[model samples]
Target: MVAPPPIIVLAFFCGTSIARSASPGPARPAKPAPIAADARHKQLTFRNRPRVVRSGRMRRMNMSTSQPGTEIGYTWPIRVYYEDTDAGGIVFYANYLKFFERARTEWLRACGVDQHRLAEENDAIFIVRSTAVDYRAPARLDDIVKIISRIERLGRASVDFVQEAWREGTLLATGSVRIGCVDRATLRPAAIPPSVLAALRHGPGTSESAD
Candidate 1:
C-alpha cells in the first residue's frame, strides 16, 4: 500500500484525538431534589402509621379469667367516626376520655340512675374529678371499639372507675376516672342520694370493690 502524506496523516491523527477528547464520558445520574422538611415528616408518619384492621376482620377481646379479682361490668361498643381521628387516621388521645365517659354514663343508665332525674330531684350532679390514662396501641378510623367500665371504688360522695378501650384482642388505652357528686345550685361536693347509691350497689352487672 502507498504511504499517506505526513501532513494529512498528522492532521487525521490530531482530529481523531480531538474528537475523542471532546466526546462525553459515561453520563452521570442526575441529583435528586431535596425533600421539604414537612414533606419528609409526613412521609415518615405515613410509613410508621399504626396497623389498621378492617372491621370485618375484627374480633372481640375475650374477657376471660385473665383479669382476676376484677369484675367486668357493662361494655359499650362505639364506632370510630372521622371526627374522632387525627390527620393520620388514628384516634386522638383526648377522644379516649370521651369514650370512657360514654361507657360510664351507660353503666349508670343500666343501673337505673338517671343523671337528669338525679339532678332535678336530688339537686345533685356527677362531675369528673380527675382522670389518669395510659395509651398503648392506637385505634384507627372505622374501627368498632369496646369500652369496658368497671367500678373500682364506691364511696359516699364519689366513685372511682377503671375503663379500657379494646379493638379485637388488642388493648388500645386504659383509664382511671374519679367522679364526684356536686350540688346543682352550688356546685359544691354533695353526697350521692340513698336511693341512687342503693341502685348503684345492686344494679344489674354492677359490682363495687369493698372500701
Candidate 2:
C-alpha cells in the first residue's frame, strides 16, 4: 500500500473532532403562572381536592361534605396538579383560598344562584364580609384535596358557611365564611333576593346542578 501524504497526516490533528463528543445546550425550565383564589372564596377562604364520602353527597377530596338531604349544602371534588403548587412543590397557602372558592361557587351553582345574572337583574352581588381560615396540614403540589361547604346560616342579606379542606382523609384547612348581598353600584348592603333565598333553603336538585 502507498504511504499516506505527510502534509495531510499532519493537518488531521488540528481538524474538527468526532460528532459523538459534542455537548448539548442546557435545558430551560417552564415559567409558572400567577396564583389567585377561586371565585367562591372571593367572599370566603376555601379550596377543593379529592375525597370519597360514603353518603355520596359529594365531599372535597380532602374535605368533609354534606350528607344526603342537608338543606342548602353541597360538596365538590378537586384534584391538585403541578400548576396548583409553588416552588417547593407544595400547594401554596393562597391556593387553598382558591380551592375553597371553587367548592363554594359550585355549591352556589347547586343552589341555583347565578351571581352574574343576579348582579345584572337585581343590581346586587355577594361580597365576602369576613373569612377565618386555619391551616391544619401542609398540602403538596400533587396532593388531592377535598373542599366541603355547608350553609351554617342564611340571613335576609347574608349567608354564613363552614368550609373545610382535606387531604388523604385528613383535615388540611378549615374556615368560616360570611358573605353579604351588596348593591353592584354602591357596594352597600342589600337584601338577598327572595328567589335566591328560596333556592338556598332547598339543596341542589337531583345533585345535578352546579354553581
Cα lDDT for residue 84, candidate 1: 99
In terms of lDDT, the poorest run of 10 residues in model 2 is: 58-67
Tens-digit lDDT track of model 2 for 48-126:
5445446455232222344433423455778988888889887888887788888888988887789999999999998
Q: How accurate locally, in lDDT, is each candidate?
A: 0.82, 0.72
Off by over 4 Å in 2: 1-73, 204-211
Error of 2 at 18 (Å): 99
Structural similarity to truth (TM-score) of each candidate = 0.65, 0.61
Scored by Cα lDDT, where does model 2 land?
0.72
Q: Which ten residues in a row are the worst by lDDT in model 1? A: 57-66
Q: Which ranges in model 1 have alpha carbons more than 4 Å from their true place?
A: 1-71
